[model samples]
Target: MTLSSSDSASLPAERLGGLLQSASFHPQQTIALGISDLAEQAKEDRADKLGISCAEEVGSVYAAILGAIVHRDAGLAD
Candidate 1:
């Protein structure tokens, strides 16, 4: 499943994981690791407004989608 920017935001974490895992775009572990990195970034950036946990969840998803864009732009995936 190739992800496009328009629809990436709507994908659930599990679904995104499945797509990344099944496609083997880059490395599954690398993508998985982004969850924590993204969550931390989100918490740092949005915790004041959205609260810690909520911002983490939002940040994780946003980061994952952004990562996908990076991968695509880098020609890591078709």
Candidate 2:
């Protein structure tokens, strides 16, 4: 799910999330320990990501995704 310089304004959040989910970054590892532990869904996946030490890349990846989502949702990317 790669995007070129153009046509990026139309990318959807859910679609992007699906792509990100397949990446090396993992949400559970980046999130705080207590919070990650409390999350019931994807707990095992999260733990696995943590075990693999993917936490460092998660925040930046999430922020970029959020920025894109916000831009599209607000019609500001145009």
Candidate 3:
């Protein structure tokens, strides 16, 4: 997803770092939180998780997002 100035300002890495410094936290929790945060940022920017921008670029954006998601899921043969 495209990041806006406001959203990018916080940067998930910084948030992850803060969470990591906490002793009681776990990696899964961090990943979940980061994903959630990324999703929120994506929502704000009107871009999909795969960084497709349908509003500005039209159909290609949706196609790109879908293709990327599928490709990632498909990956290499096991």
Highest-TM-score candidate: 3
lDDT scores of the candidates, listed in order = 0.70, 0.58, 0.64
Better of 2 and 3 by TM-score: 3
Highest lDDT against the true fold, candidate? 1
Give candidate 3's error at residue 62 in angstroms. Answer: 29
**Model 1 residue 47 distance off true place after TM-score fit, in angstroms:** 12
Question: Candidates ranked by lDDT, best first?
Answer: 1, 3, 2
Model 1 CA lDDT for position 73: 95
Give the per-residue lDDT digits (tens) of candidate 1, residues 10-69.
656776666567556555555555555566766877757667678789999999999999
Model 2 is weakest, by summed lDDT over 10 consecutive residues, at 29-38
**Candidate 3: TM-score?**
0.35
TM-score for every candidate vs. truth?
Answer: 0.34, 0.30, 0.35
Better of 1 and 3 by TM-score: 3
Candidate 1 clashing pairs, residues 3+ apart or interchain: none
Q: List the residue pairs that clash in candidate 2.
A: none
Q: Candidate 3 on 1-78: residue-level lDDT in tens?
A: 333568546776677566556525565666567678778887877655345543557677788888888888999324
Give residue 67's error in model 1 in angstroms. Answer: 0.4
Q: What is the model-wide C-alpha lDDT for candidate 3?
A: 0.64
